[model samples]
Target: MSEREDFVRRFGGVFEHSPWVAERAFDRAASVGLTAGNVHSALCNAFRAASPAERRAVLRAHPDLAGKLALAGKLTAASTVEQASAGLDRLSPEEHQRFTELNAAYMKKFGFPFIIAVKGLTKEDILAAFERRIDNSPEEEFETACAQVEQIARLRLRSMLPGEDNA
Candidate 1:
């Protein structure tokens, strides 16, 4: 594959479904030769600099935690693994129902799914955060979602590149 294609193939899903973040970060990655930290910073800078609508698109691109996409086995590969890591994939019926309710409420209030980097968190932790964040103002929720997206991207890059201050 060509270098650009390779770059995108590797890092595109770092930002959920928003490959545009990878597309935008490519120039920087090329310039800096693809260290984990450089690639992570480039991708995050692109995400952070996006217009509100574009950033919201990134947020909207995320699958809801333990929601329909996951139920239907439709989450991206990275998402599947991450959710499993948090035990979200093993939620009981009651837990799933609670996630469903919180997801609906959160979406109704914020116009996007509740997003958190689930790498080192438990289902209870995620549930607690979901409940707590539902009370945030729209602006606060938007910023929080964006930051979570960045964290997710950072973790994804860390997995791919390893051994850098991608944190």
Candidate 2:
């Protein structure tokens, strides 16, 4: 089989179980020229061989909200924040005002959105992280951002490939 095919077969195992996610994964892989079966297999092998922490780190390295005009290299960062804040319309007016203020301050302080992977996290957990992280120094916040990016990427990978050895 070709490298891409192998990649699709192996790493794709995670995604294949979820066809919608698989399609998106395939599109992403293809965009990066892992379109060949063998190449894909190699990529999958590499991803699978990584330690769980390493995988998480890789995910975190991405810029949040990849394509957003405001985020620049921080697309994933923006998207994660947006996703986490999705239900904020349910908040009271005061709560909404506080969130907006917090978000603005976070951006002003960190030069990026406060980001955390929302998958598997409760809304309260997300809110807490946002509040707590705002107190971090720029250097500390940068590292925290990096960590969050990895977490988000790992979560995306896991969602894309469920049954595979995520480690």
lDDT of 2 by residue, 21-139 (tens): 23335545655553334234434445545565544444433433212322333333434454545553255566556667777787777666666766666556667888888999987
Poorest 10 consecutive residues of model 2 by lDDT? 15-24
Compute each candidate's TM-score over C-alphas.
0.95, 0.51
Q: In candidate 1, where is summed lDDT lowest over 10 consecutive residues?
A: 158-167
Predicted model with the maximum TM-score: 1
Clashes of each: 0, 29
Model 1 C-alpha lDDT per residue in residues 92-147, reported as the tens digit of each score: 99999999999999999999999999998999999999999999999999999999
* Models, CA RMSD each: 1.1, 9.7
Q: Give the TM-score of candidate 2.
A: 0.51
lDDT of each: 0.91, 0.51
